[model samples]
Target: MKVKMILPALTEAISPHWRPIKYSLFPPLGLATIAAFFQLDDEIVIQDEHIEAIDLEDEPDLVVIQVYITSAYRAYELADYYRQRGIYVALGGLHVTALPEEASLHADTIFIGPGEDTWPQFLKHWQVGKPEKVYVSRERSLIDLPKIRRDLIKRHLYLVPNSIVVSRGCPHHCDFCYKESFFKGGKSFYTETVDRALEEIAELPGRHLFFLDDHLFGDTRFASGLFDGMKGMGRVWQAAGTVHAVLQPNLLEKAVESGLRSLFIGFETLNSTNLRQQHKYHNLNRDYTEAIRRLHDLGVMINGSFVFGMDEDDETVFDRTVEWAINNGIETATFHILTPYPGTDLYQRMATENRLTSDNWDLYDTRHVVFQPNKMTAEVLEAGYLCAYRDFYRWNAIFQSVSTKNTWEQKLRHLIYAGAWKKFEFLWDLIIRAEQVNKVLPMLESVLDGFGKKSAIAIIA
Candidate 1:
């Protein structure tokens, strides 16, 4: 069967007048992983709309669309478009998993939960013209899964094209986390074999890899075995994990020795009350300074993530968090306004209180504030989010954070990273201006055309 797989982009990301220059920051691993399950006879075409245009003119037997909450509307549009042309459409991902019925209205078949088990079954039935309306997977075993078909991807498009997923789901089910809904029962699972992971890494072209796992150290036993297997591989990687995992007995040392260069930790809030409210109590037990010091001592850079607008937070949260991060020599910090995504506990509570401002999925991005805060206004939350970013990326903060680096190269790299964050803010402003121009361009063009026609008439006269 001829199949076309799509990784839909948010409308704002693909606007003619306002597209981001750095659209292909990451390849669509989800689509590629799904593509890996297809038979050799299946002629497949993959399109990542964020990096390139979708060829709507292509005629395929089936269309597979990956859905994210921010791209839900666009995914629905693409599904409807392909379906109108008599193509079978399959929709799956976090968004569809959350609202399968709503997605079913647009696609021929919708998948709930992970596609590892359901996808192959659907494909088998599809070939015989007996595809089901919904396919659901209840498997928790993360063994014997096929390696992602990186050959299907245009690797040159992504900044870091070489990546792998060693684990799935996260144990810490924070109130605002979408993982709680995506993973059935919010259970974290690890790959049964480290040999398969090592084989995948060996096949890849690059020495540096990025593990797209929700949390690499969520399961210490699996992590320890994986790290021990990776020790002699001579490959460096970065992944996300909790502070508790880093401080685990003997695991952190083994992980670093195995080439874990950096980690992204969710130090969500500085306040203990906020941590409890978010159900991120694990973060409260460890001193933030001690965690940062230990990670830095292991020659690993820290990418600390923080969120504003928790019930126990006030405007002071931003400055305090930024200052703490800078003081502790954090390599980088990502700030977010508290966002209540669909299918999250926070969203349910906000809906019950009638505090949700809108169901606009586009605005659900972490940068936007969609719900009322308990202690401060939404405006204040938004402002604080911006302030946190600006302060963290400021020159003084960057210098302070890099001062502890042992080598000049490390210091220089951190400085460059800080500058990149600053430039990102500029790029954001440029997009907004481009959007404004997009809104008025048609009218401007019409006026110019009228003026040219009148000028031609005068010349004829």
Candidate 2:
């Protein structure tokens, strides 16, 4: 039977500034890896909807859709469209894992947890004409799976190739983070023997590598060994990690000498109280300014992350964060509204308190504000988030950050995308605030009235 896998885009609309208009496709790593599992006789096609329009006329016997929360709506729409044509539809990925029942409405088969173990079983069942309603396996360690097939990834998707994952799970239980749910409360780190990781990198032709690990240097000692192995490979790499990891002097030096170029660090909020309450990794005694300075001194550019909408946050939170980022010389920053995703602690708390505004999956996008806030109205939270983005990516701010850089190319890329960031913030504010004012304000006011007043400053400080 003909099988096709679809990787939906984060959004249906393309941002010309962020993505090259001429080349709009991203390598669907998850779908590409799944395609590798098919046998030689099985005809498997991979479709990235972002790169090209979906050709429903191809008429595959089976269709698999992989989606994240940002692309949940598009996945549902595609599933419905294909199912109507008598195609068997299966749903998997982060969104499906979070809300299987909601996803089941559109899918004939829904797979939760890691797809590696369950996908092969499901395929065997399909061959026998006995596909189950749902297929789920206990989260498998990455060490159990074979090296992901990079050959399936189309060359066009690689501005810089050589993506590999060294770890799977996180230990932190951040309120707004989905990582806590992805691993289901347990920490799962897969140590793919240093020899194996480096061997794969050595074989790949690209000089630039992107480690897809949630955290690359998970265990400092293990990371040092990996760094030693990576030295001979002669490639520069980038990956995501926490500020705590970067603060370790030995790991920081090893990362820099081992060719680490950029690191994505989750600085989440400037509010220390919110950080502690959420159980985020925060060193209360250490100076954050000093930590940032140390990393920059080591020549590693930080892509700092921040989230707005904790009970402690107010209108001034935006300016405070912007000032913190600027003072520390953060190379790049991403600001998001706090989203209470299903299966997360924050989601359960909001649901229990009846602070959830709607069950619409589309509104759950991290860019939108979907729940009632304790310290401020929904309008204030939405506007504050937008203002934060605007203020951070303002022309002067971008210019200042980029000018401090050594290369003109880096400065140009920042300039090219700055306008798009501003537009995204403006559009997000309009949609989120309007939805709240028209539909959720009354319900929110009633809840807040009964909850009683407490100092927002005291909570966030």
Candidate 3:
């Protein structure tokens, strides 16, 4: 059997947003991981549309496409194009898992859960010419999964080419999260063996890696062992976890010693009531200041994630959240509007109340306000979302956060990263206006040159 596995660009047509920046930022690990599950005898070809254009002319017996909410329309187009050529097409990923019925219109076969469990069954059925319309697997059996087929990846295309996942799913069941819906249950987590994890890391080409877990320290025991094993590797890494997890005794200290240079924390809302309403009760009593202090003290730069448009949020929410992040010395902040994806609890409730403004999957990217909020109009929510980005990432705020806090190494890292995001905010324009990129390069160089000679221990020059 011959296969073509793809990670589609977010739209039917290419744009500056994906072509020049987003594609280079990360490799399509999802497609490559799924490729690992295919039999060795099956000839496999992979293309990440963000990195390269799709080859519709390639004749393969099977084509597997991963779909995300924003990429659904383009994925459907790809599927239709392949099916028209009489090639079998399979669709999976969070978007298709949420709306398998809609996805079935495009794909000859649809996978409803983790592709690790469903893909093999599809292959078995295909061999007999009895391909099922949908294969659903709600099992939580993720141990000893095969390592990703890194050979299939175009490593040089990604900014962070070395990526690995230590775990799958999160324990917390946030109402708006699709993890619970995809896994068919909340409060379940799965991990590969620690030794296997280390082996995968050691084999990768670079010293810097990204552990792609939604919550890296979700299982404390597993994390402890993983950290212990990683301590001797002398590599720098980053991962995401809940605020409460980092506060555990000696866990942060050990992780830092084990090359944990950065963390992506989901501080979804500053309002405690919004946290509770969304069932993220674990953050209820935790001190946000203390959490930031501990992480910064350990030299771990934070990529704080926040969301607006919750039920408790209003016009005041945007400024409050942005100001809180700035005052807290957050290195980088990502803001989003509340997006209730299909098949999640939040979507059901919003649908029942007739609060959903649109069913367009493309608008569900969190950059757009797809649902009506109880406290503000959708137009206001959209405007405020963009405003929050501008407020947090403005040049003045970026300089203050980088210059005034953290160690020199952390400061340099934060400066370069924050500078890149500021450029990204104007990337679409930068493409059309050639002079824009030229103007930003010198500013970025000045920032970097100022800190390059300083000692790592120096907090201020």
Candidate 4:
């Protein structure tokens, strides 16, 4: 039987400028791993609609879609389309895991947890013509499942062929985070027994690795052992970790020695109040300048992440954050609007207070505002985000940051990202203007309806 894996984008209409981009740079490592589960008798094809259009003419026996909250809408649309064409559709990933009932409306079957242990059973059931509504695994730890097939790696693009997971689950229970709910009781992680993980990494010809673990250094001993095992492999890798790991000078040096070139750190916010409120690990109260300098001195490029729209944040938060990034010499940073996903604590609290704007999952994309704010109107929050993006990616700011960074490669990456930022500037401006014209102005007018025109204009301004 033929099985096709379809990876849908966050939207169907690809901006003409975004089409030529290659998939390897930010490939869907999750769906690629699932492709390894099928047998030789089954024909497997992978389609990423973000880079190329999906051609349904090459029919398959079954269609599987992997998605996250951002891409949930596109996934549903694809599922509905394929199901109408008589294709058996299956949905998996964080979005479906959090809302199976909502997902089941579009899919014939939805896999709740990790697909490694449940996918084969799903396939077996499908072969017998008895597909179930939901396929779930109670396994709390990462099982020693099959490694991704290296032969399936596409060489034309800048993709990491050898991707592996060293651990799973996080202990940090941040209010605006889904990890807190996904692994509620406690943290859980399972390594691939050092030798096996090393062997898999060694087998890949690309010599570049992408560790999908949410936190690579969640366990210090296991992380150190994994680093030691990777020595002399002539491989360069990148992984996500908490600022606590980055602060450990010795561990940071050891990781550099083991060919670690880039590290993604969840700085979350520059505001100490927001950090303390969220209970984020690492000392947010510490001098961020010193912390960033320490990592840069160790030759590790830091990809800092920040979230906006916390209760403590106000209009000034945007300029303050941009200034922080510029002063710290942060190379690449991702700024996301706060999203309260269904299973997370933030979601429950907002729902209880009746602050949720709508149940439209499509708008749940981190870029949009889905809940009412305590401090500022949604328009101010939205405008702040766009202004921040514009300020950081301005030509002068980009040049200053790139020149300050240590290496030429680092400078080039920053330049490329800055160019991409310029292209998306229009979209960011549209989001800001839309909030002001459609929501903010109308609501303010309603509140000042009885007041004089002069007072209403003053209030708006």
Model 4 C-alpha lDDT per residue in residues 135-237, reported as the tens digit of each score = 8765554456677654554433333434567666654557777655545333345455767677777776644566778888877877888899888886677
Q: TM-score of every model? A: 0.88, 0.83, 0.90, 0.83
How many residue pairs of model 3 clash at the backbone?
0
- Tens digit of per-residue lDDT, candidate 2, span 116-191: 6778888899889999999876756555455555665655533333566665665555776675665653334556
Q: Global lDDT for candidate 4?
A: 0.70
TM-score, model 3 to reference: 0.90
Ranking by TM-score: 3, 1, 4, 2
Off by over 4 Å in 3: 12-14, 17-20, 185-187, 406-413, 424-461
lDDT by residue (tens digit), candidate 1, 224-291? 88889888876667789888887776888898888887789998888888888888878877877777
Top-TM-score structure, candidate number = 3
Model 3, 99-196: lDDT tens digits are 88899999988888777777767777888899888888766566767778889887665556777886788878899897778888322568878888
